[model samples]
Target: MLDKHQAVQSHQKKSSRQKLAKVLLATLPMLTVLGATAGLSSCGFQLRGYDTPMLFDIAKTAVIIEDNRTAFPLKLPLTRRLEALGLDVIDNMTLADIANNSNNVGADPIAAITVNNIRFKRYELVGVLTEIRLVLSADVSYQTIENGKPVTLSNPIQVERSYQYNEASVSTDDQQGNQIRDWLYDTLARRITDQYVAISLPKVAPASANKSSQTLKSPEKTTVIVPSS
Candidate 1:
């Protein structure tokens, strides 16, 4: 009878120990979470900014075809946008430079672009060239290094924008035109970057590897729609 009572007591003690251990084990995670929360709140730290470099194949070269005519304002904005996105822009390099120049005879290139046209249509005041209509067009040619060879990937991205002006609101016209151009440049930049990275970069190893939702970034320049002048 005594032995039975002792065994029962022993089992009860064992069960109590197990329950306490489980409670402790569960408390550990909660304690850890609380500690992290406390530490963050105490520090008062805040996230400021982020960086996302443009993705490309391991090693791909790029060249930009320069626009000779300086009368139009397109290439500069486009080039700036590309550079900001961390692309290897082939500046001061021409199609003749690639084809005619012996230096670029054999190169593993990624992409190239030429500003086919950047014109300002003169919307005349009573048949006079008074108001300017801004239009920008480009031809994008891309190639990728595949199995030790350069494969041509021709993807032309063309965008046109126009603005009507009133002599009374010259400042407004200038501001509106700039905003429109900036937006167009940013859109084109992203399109080209995605294409280049998808084609050139390895599928498994993407340029942007972070799975976080914060990878994609908004353009630096914001466009505010202005009332037509």
Candidate 2:
């Protein structure tokens, strides 16, 4: 009876895993297209010989944590990575500062990298040798300002990473945890930087009625017009 119960449990877990895998597979195509469009529109089609690597097509940018209550440490690493890619990092900007910077004359419109959510998950496997799995996931979006109005990217970046370790090693658990955190931070930052390369800056004038008073429209189903081979 115990053996039968264990087999049933194992089958249930396998079915759950398969279902999750299918969902991920279905979303992969959409995510791929969106990221490609982001890099091209934001970076102005580097494939055509443009030589700039800044993700937002803007002179200055700042990273903001949308929810400060979470105590997540992703902002600093992401900022450093963005700067390394040639973006002008404006430090010490508060959410209030970002809101108030709109529509000012000669003011460099500040683009923002906003992180919306962060989550951690853990799974423990029981066997002859027990194992543990850890996952870190974050949802992020970018906003570009044109003529002082904000246009947010429709497709947000979702980054996830998983790590596994032996459950018996209680002595090294703390060290392993720290290592996983750092690894997750690095991976998150790296993927964010990479995706930004495809984005293009909004046109400076932004086609307003008065030329100066016009607001930019945020794209919903942004598509890339790829050249035919």
Summarize candidate 1's per-residue lDDT along 84-107 as a digit string, tens digits.
444556666666554444346464
Give Cα-based local distance difference scores for all models. 0.54, 0.65
lDDT string, candidate 2, 12-116, tens digits? 999999999999999999999778756644543433322343245476777766555332577778877776555777767865787678656667778777666
Supply the global lDDT for candidate 2. 0.65
Best by lDDT: 2
Q: What is the lDDT of residue 28 in candidate 1?
A: 100
Clashes of each: 1, 12
Position 114, candidate 2: lDDT = 65
Model 2, runs deviating above 4 Å = 1-56, 66-71, 146-149, 154-164, 170-174, 201-229
- How high a TM-score does candidate 1 get? 0.43
